[model samples]
Target: MESTEWHLTSFVNLAVLTFLFLCSQGQVNGDCPADGRTWVPFGQSCYYFVHGNEDRFKSYTIEKAKEMCKDYGLLTVRSAEENSFIVENSLQVWKGGNNNMWLGMYYNSDDDEFKWNDESHVTFKNWEEGDAEDPEMPLIDTCVILHAASGKWENVSCSEQPQHGVVCETPQIRLQRKNASPLLSALVVISVIMILGISAAVWFLQQRKGSGSTLFPSFEYHPPFRAPSADQTCLVEAEEIDETS
Candidate 1:
């Protein structure tokens, strides 16, 4: 009896463990990717963030890139957590390569301040190397990040144009407009479909009617079988008499 009780307890414990294991696996499956990536949905664009590789290339000036992202309804790379996540995952992306890329920041000479494309103040400075300096031309005041091994922030004189990779920001207007007024659009589509269906039905009925008339003409005046006339009767009687004679 003692041995039987021990076996029953052991079985219960094993079943509990199995249930727990299954529950853990279920939780894992329901969670996000194990690689520490997140999904971003902005405008018509969808972005995935994974950490670790920074050796890709798609160069553009920061402003131009921001405009491009805006056109596609996306934002610039502005999150430290996201950046760190990407770094941790060792994911390669276009804007995080070896070359000095343009961020969504520029030096505004008129205002004598660093301004973001969104007209925000440039408080966050993370430049890399020999940037934002032109001893000969003081008027060439612009902000750019250095791409040296140190990867420090530097202020340098922006020349005519630099073909650098860019981090972009899509404008809010575009995203707000995308897929907006869905109910009305859907209603319009449904109405059009209904109209087309009704028109096709009418056309099909008309065609069927036309084909029926052609295939079987309607005879409105059908003649009936008539009895013989008086002349016909006299002729018949004369023929009968001849035959008898």
Candidate 2:
């Protein structure tokens, strides 16, 4: 029974020690970004596709689409990966047979440059043949659209074209609760280890007391002088009597 308890205690101590070590090392928990309101997670951002007649109006222009996406996130493409993700997931976003949607790209005739709605740098482009140009009327097609059928881009007049849907995107959020300072985490870990150590020490002492065991057993010491036996006493008396005689 004592051996069983000892083994169980050893296992508990080992587990506690392992937990302490892991805590001290500050291992981060595997927490992914949350996808809310049916938004899809791709890479480091969350994407939302607005389509169907449920919340959409009869006609939605680029400016109206931008207003709708304002509450969700900015209406723009951040990278080529994001653009590809949008293309692949286009059908899933809107299944009402519409193949074209508004992107965040717009051409500015003032600077003679195409830029995103958020005014970010345009590092990637996926324009189709003859897109983003007007041979007869230059600077007429300013807004961009993702052509689902061709999986490419085409520029249309922002005010002239009516879109069936819009794609909104924003960066993924990191959980703030898990981001503790290293010193605070270390202090918490050390406190837990100390508490476990103290509890184990007390338990060990209690077990030793109940088992009547000592770390170093001491022996009782006796004097060399001992009381004489009956025979020895009689012999001593007789010798004393003879001497007296």
> For this target, which candidate reaches the highest lDDT against the unseen true structure?
2
lDDT (CA) for every model shown? 0.49, 0.68
* Poorest stretch of ten by lDDT in candidate 1: 26-35
lDDT of 2 at 225: 94
Ten contiguous residues with the weakest lDDT in model 2: 27-36
Whole-structure CA lDDT of model 2: 0.68
Q: Please give the distance, in angstroms, between residue 161's alpha carbon in candidate 2 and its true position after superposition.
A: 4.4
lDDT tens per residue, model 1, 100-189: 445546667788766666777755455443344445556335645434234444554456556554433322222111332657556655
Clashing pairs in 2: none
Tell me how many clashing residue pairs each candidate has.
Answer: 28, 0
TM per prediction? 0.36, 0.56
